[model samples]
Target chain A: MLNFLSTALVPLLASLIVLAGLRRRLDLFACFAEGARQGMGSILSLVPTLVALMVGVEMLSASGLLELLGRALAPAARLLGLPEALMPLVILRPISGNGSLSVLGDLIAKNGADSLVATAGAVILTSTETTLYTAGVYFGSVGARDTGPTIPAALLSDLIAVLVGGGLVKLMLFS
Target chain B: MLNKIWAGMILISTLAGLALGRGAELSGAVFTGCSRALSLAVTLLGVAAFWSGLMHIAEQSGLLAAFAGLLRPLIRLLFPGLGRGGGAEQAIAASMTANIFGLSGAATPLGLRAMAELAKGQPRGMASPHMQMLVLINSASLQIVPATVVALRQEAGSAAPFAIMPAVWLTSAATLVAGVLLLRLLTALARPRRQRASEKGGLRRC
Candidate 1:
């Protein structure tokens, strides 16, 4: 059920419905081609920015800095009612989506799938956005030089999401 | 902001990698990171192409306008300076709709289009409030389905991956609210004191 919803069903259904509804009046194939071409161009241009940010995140994680940082922030994690196991995940969550995913996978593997820590990690993974990546790619694509308020706003929101995600999991599942 | 963060990441990684005697690993990560990002862009290419193509059909069929109409009230509240019926509004609404359905890959191309639309006629390096808020909102996306999380849980052999629905819903909402509020507050605080500066003629008015 979950597989169907995520991978294929919803998107296919939505596309089919939209196509069916719009068939009579427009040249659908032409529109698709134009849009797809533009899409490709956008993604192509974003590759450099994405690569720069990803390398930053990847090296940060591989250099043991993440571990040191996580250890330092572990006490704050406890203060927020989050398990110590979640410290690295929360810290890495906003910086790198794929990095956090691997960490979440490791967490679930270590602590059973149904464990409170795993559940909270899963929720945090789902709820929080990758702040640095989004800022880099999206703003880079637009050629925006001054990211005046976006980064700080996104970081604060991520902080809130992490805390809220942990708190909710604790209240709902552990109680 | 982005330049600083990128430089900081490089600086920290280099210092830490050398100190920890993992210099080789750090160098390898640079190459691997490039490949990983390339593959990610390739994956997003497919997702973005399909959705953008579909959205083009919707736009040609006038469905895009109808969709933007539905979101106008909220869009207006968030971006009061944006003109109605403009490309930015259509792009933003399409992106938000795609995001709501939990397709970040698809949402991104639409967001890029929206940003481009918003960037038109603006100064080369300056980002308008609308652009700033849009970036923040997109960065802190609120998805209704969160299909990725469910799929991850299912793969991990959880009995019910969808069981985290409540947590997903609550947490996303909180982040969206917090992000928007912070954007509003910070932008207000960060604005230049143009009145005082203008009186002294210290800065030229654009």
Candidate 2:
């Protein structure tokens, strides 16, 4: 762990810090501030869906829909050779990464940090999150809501990422 | 209007969902389960509706215009070709906000609107620098909340899901840098030829 921190985390941190500094240029900062403000404003537009989405997930879990889904997905995970517990992670990941992470963390704890679940978590970490919703916020801010070209691309990218993460980790480490 | 319709449908569906959940002839425990799922969906849609409406009011009031003014200069400097349409500035702001709050679902509408704005200003046969920049930035966004990650970790019963805060901060920086660097490369390659042909024509006329 110490070696990983030294070799990976530190260097990554250094470069990222440098990039952050560069992004703070007057022009970039302006863009960032503007972007943030618009994002917030647009968020105001979808408050209901936002709230519903969150609560809906919670309700689903409470309703045992997730448990049902979990069981249904178990066979698929087994075929994929993924840890069944991580199915929650896969399902909720698209709706909300934060939600998914909580489940992933639990699985990791139960299955052990060194298990396939843990490694898969790392891979998923490096990929995109909440893509469709995000694409909407940015587009909506401009007052145009059509996601014709972008949605397909973003979803495709996300799907590829999931399989890639799960597959790579399985072949290299789990195998 | 569409939202209202969607809301009604969702509401009815959820209620029906409640019945379906509770209606198990065989499994008595099913009622307990369906009630919880429908209940959650109701709560989430309700809040999202409020926030989304707030944005509409802001839009009608022209707040986006005012906000766009401040970022215009900066946007122009970086995205000189936005030419009035890139609407990149607004889109960037909106996308950032979505990422920050983890409102990915709501973010898309605005992002598309903003991109259309950018496309509107672009000249024929030339891509809008602002639009491209938006794409790059969105691709490598530096998230503030990473709500999904947090939620996932928490759901999984992590002892310290928030521990990824440092990792997120670090990665955003790295990704931002990578994105900007890529944009810089693209810009260098597509810097509009510096008005050379027009300048040469003027010089000859002189």
Candidate 3:
């Protein structure tokens, strides 16, 4: 039942929007074209950042630094009852969305799709925003020099979310 | 900050490769990384574009505004100082609505406009409490449908792409509540200090 709902969600949403547009007498095709163009532009702008981050993350993993770092942080992760593999994702998540997504892909590849690590990673990714990027853009837009506890508060919240998400995934999915 | 992190990763990776005698492997990783990024982006493009287009239709048909209207009471509670039906209020509502619906392409612009509106008549270069709350809420965005993550999970061949939805919703709500409480606490703590500082300044002037 849940699987069917998930599969139906996108088509349902699309149909609903289209029907609404028709009812409003909108030029749906033209609107879609314009928005799709904007989406393409946004994706293009993301390419460079993705390339840079992916290279860095790949090199980190390929050179075995990630493993070393993971081992170094293993005690802390153990204390939190988290897998060592999730260290990179936890750190990269708040910094870069694409970077964290790359880490998440690697996590799912290393651990099976149904593994606790992958589920936890997915939950964390879905729940948390890219804190640094969001802060930069939101504050930068208004020329606000003093962010005044926004970043710290947000990061604290993200940490709570990540920890809670890992636990939730374990309890909900695995159990 | 991002610059530092990105450069540090490259430099550390190079040094590690040299130390580990994996220069050839490191070079290979560069190509693989770029290709991986491109592939991932290609996978994402279709979903992102389709969703963006669909959201555009929704926006044009006034569906988004209707959703925003539904969020007005919540907005009023979250952003207390905004005048009812004012620009900031409306922008905040729209942005929050877009965010919940996972239309980040629209959310960012609306969020920026809301920030600009909230910043009006505020102290120069200082973020008002309302502005801070706005950014905080955005950073802890409570997305009802995590479309991007679901799409990525699907691309990764997950048997159940939306299996994590319940967890996502739980975590998002928790984080948003925690963030709001923390922001309120910080703002409350800062207010007295600012007032005391101003009092000291007045004394110095006398």
Candidate 4:
């Protein structure tokens, strides 16, 4: 399957990407219209979720909840050799990749980027998804809310990514 | 939230132990170390806001659609669940946007916005499950540019920061395929048991 994803899927998908540019299929404009409509509609909701999550995280920081979460998750983080504070970022990364990228930036700087720290940060870049983001936009567009076990499953999957990322980095880059 | 702090404590202690084991004078200096991260976090909050907003604007302006038009069939193949409908086209397009650009942060709000839009008239209870599918797919996300990784390598002063792109591409392939397979397997395994239980319970009896 992995072989297919890389050898077959990626190449085929990338090559077919040229089809989008064929001047005849002006449907590009329509899709943009669709995206714009979707974007405008969600702007209002974005305000609340952003404010709530950002403020909640900030509050967690001030209230020492961040620290507590770190300690509690230390064993788990150690298993991945990640910083406990990284947990929140891990949680947030899948929801907001750029936000986590920004966080990973800070981690790299502090840890002397060339070390395992930077390498692990890089692995995280490849691993995990933005949970809230994907769900919100996809479901809102289609109007489906029955998400089933996607959340739990994705979380578990990302956790595995964290471990794999750390292990790989430790061997290739850090070591 | 307070209870979650234990993880941090453990991490700090482990690092401290490492510091001590290494006999470094700066051992147990996590407080001093994270100071940089705190300051950076403040700066990044704005950066995050800007980038996310930019992605929204891009999506709004049709940049993503242009990209999506290019990859429709392949995406359809990857996300058969999304089908070939208009929404599937858009969803796959948005995903492609996030992946190619490495806008990991921007993808979240956009993803949520995507789901809300997708669920517009889906059968009532179907909303949550479909949204979960979106999340899972996003989590198993693939990347090409890997801006974050490059940034980390540069910060670390790597000899060739972007050299690892090949590895990243390879690993992402592995993870994505594995993740999809795992989810499918789990779902398939759970279906019968769920049916049995649901049969016993039923939705209603007139």
Candidate 5:
């Protein structure tokens, strides 16, 4: 069942059913085309910001800045009772989901399925999001100028999630 | 603020790259990064377009309204600025549902549409409180069923992959609750400051 959903077949199946059901009242193709056009336009407008952010992120990661930051934060992670190795996962969790997902896959492979680190990684991933990416895309789409308090709020939430995830794993599995 | 962050990222990365004596690597990363972003946009174009269309059908079929009705009370509290029974509410509800289901891919278009709606009639540079709430809520997305994590565990040969359900549920719920409370607190704190500014005519622009 999880595998079935993993393929995104569930949403696709549901969309097909919905479209088929609505086709009589609405011109489904026309609606889809209009929506697709709008989506494309937003995507095109967002390319510049996306490229800027992605390049920044890539440089940070490739230049070993993330590793350096992760190393510096290791003690804090340890203080939260999580493994020091999870430092990278915590650091990368909010910036890029793909980066963190790969890190998570590696952690699970290295530490086994039911290990505390892997469990915490899964929980953290579920709890948090790709903050910078989502904010950039969403705000860029809407042309909202002031991120205002959103970034700080999101980062704080990510920090809390990381701590709570590790704490929960420690209490539930370790204790 | 975004400009500063962007500039800071480039500056810091470049300096770090040069300090680490990896100038060649950093220069290469800029091109690779742009290409990666291009591919991402292309990938998102397909998903966003399909979902946007499907969402239109869902909206037309009244399915989205039903979903909105289900989540109305909570959404109403978060978006008091929106008028009653508005389409934006439906879009937001759909996006929130998708987020909960770990369908972030499908949620993007709906989320973007919601922001577009929320920003309507508002000043160009200012994000409404409601918009901030939506972004913060999305940032702390609560996944009830993390299918990807479960699948990853299964692939790793976990005997019972669902065993992590308790931890996932706890973490996500806790984060969401904390996020809402923090947003409330921050907004309350900001209100007085804004009220004072209004007296000085600074609030007229907003």
Candidate 6:
């Protein structure tokens, strides 16, 4: 039932919006086209920042530093009752969404999708945003230079999410 | 701050790569990253364009305003300084709506719009507390469905992909609450220092 709702949500939303527009005698096609054009412009403006950020992230990963950082944080992970295998995902989660997704995929493949680690990873991934990416794009759009405690606060929140999410998975699934 | 972080990432990666004799891999990563970002952008373009168009219709039809009306009290609590029925408020509502529905691709465009709106009339290069608050909330995931994670779990052959929904809900709520509280605490802490510094400047001028 939940799966059905999840799958149907987007299409249902689209249908409702269209129906709403029709009822109001709105030129839905023209409105949509104009919005799409605006959307494309905003996205085009983001490309350079995205490229720079992604390159930095990719370089960090490629240089083996990310893996090393993960290993370095393994003890911290263990102290928090998290699996050592999840260290990399934890590190990458805030930096890069696709990187963390691939990491989650690897975790599930190795430990089985139903394993505690994979479940915990999935929960964490779903619970937190890619902080760096989101902040970069949002602030970049407006050319806002001073983020003013935003990143730190967001990262702290992500930490809370990870701890709470992973702890619950351990309590419920591990048991 | 972002500038520093970006430069630091590149510098550290290059230094580490050379030290570890992974220069070749680092160079390869540059091109790979660009291509990856481009492909990601292309995917974002399609999803964002479709959602933006739909949302535009929603806006034209007054559906978005109605949806945002339901969230007005919450918005008032979050952004007390914002006036009623402003562009910022509407964009924020749209962004939050997209976030709750787990339409992140749609959320980004709306969020960017909100940021742009919040930036207006403010001093150049400085983010207002409201803008920072918006970014903080955006960073704290608020999705109910988490469709992407569930779909990925299904692809990974989970017998019950959505079983983790409870955990997701708990964590997302906790994170958002924590983020809000922390931001408030930080703002309160900084206010005193700011005032003292300004007063000190006033004294020096005298």
> Which rank order by lDDT, best down to worst?
3, 6, 1, 5, 4, 2
Per-residue error (Å), model 3, residue B184: 1.0
lDDT of 3 by residue, A18-74 (tens): 999999999989999888887777777888988998888898888889999999999
**Candidate 1 stretches greater than 4 Å from native:** A1-69, B1-69, B192-206
TM-scores for every predicted model: 0.69, 0.44, 0.93, 0.58, 0.67, 0.71
Point to the candidate with the largest lDDT: 3
- The DockQ scores of all candidates, in the order shown, are 0.44, 0.08, 0.67, 0.17, 0.42, 0.50
Residue range with the least summed lDDT across 10 consecutive positions in model 3 chain A: A1-10
Comparing only chain B with the true structure, the TM-scores of all models are 0.65, 0.52, 0.92, 0.69, 0.64, 0.68
Residues B1-206, candidate 5, lDDT per residue (tens digit)?
Answer: 55675687789989998999989889888887778767666655665566556655665666655655788889888778678778788778888977765554568888988998888887787788888888888888676556556666776787767666676667877887888788778778778887888788774454
Q: Compared with the true structure, what per-residue lDDT tens digits does model 6 show for residues A3-96?
A: 4664576678889989999999988889899987876776677778778877877788788887788788888998988877778788778987
Total residue pair clashes for candidate 5: 0
Estimate, for each residue in B52-110, the C-alpha lDDT of model 3 and write its tens digit.
78888888899988988999988888888679999999889988988898887778998
Interface RMSD of every predicted model, in angstroms? 6.1, 11.2, 1.9, 9.0, 6.8, 5.5
Writing each residue's lDDT as its tens digit, candidate 1 over A1-175 gives 5334534654675676476646655667787888778767777887787788768767886798877887888889778877877887887788777667556755676687788988999888888878888888877886777678789889999989988998998887678
* Clash count, candidate 6: 0
Clashing pairs for model 3 are none
Q: Under CAPRI classification, how is model 6 graded? A: medium
| Model 2 chain A: lowest-lDDT 10 consecutive positions | A143-152
Candidate 1 residue B120 C-alpha distance from true site, Å: 1.5
- Expressed as tens digits, the lDDT of each residue in B52-122 for candidate 6 is 67777877888866876798889889898797889999889989987886555578888998998998898
Indicate whether candidate 2 or candidate 4 has the larger lDDT.
4
For this target, which candidate reaches the highest TM-score against the unseen true structure? 3
Steric clash pairs (candidate 5): none
Which rank order by DockQ, best down to worst? 3, 6, 1, 5, 4, 2
Query: How do these models rank on TM-score, best leading?
Result: 3, 6, 1, 5, 4, 2
What is the per-residue lDDT of model 5 for residues A57-134, given as tens digits with 9 covering 90 to 100? 678766878668877888787677778768877876787675566567657766997888888887888778988878
lDDT of 1 at B102: 58
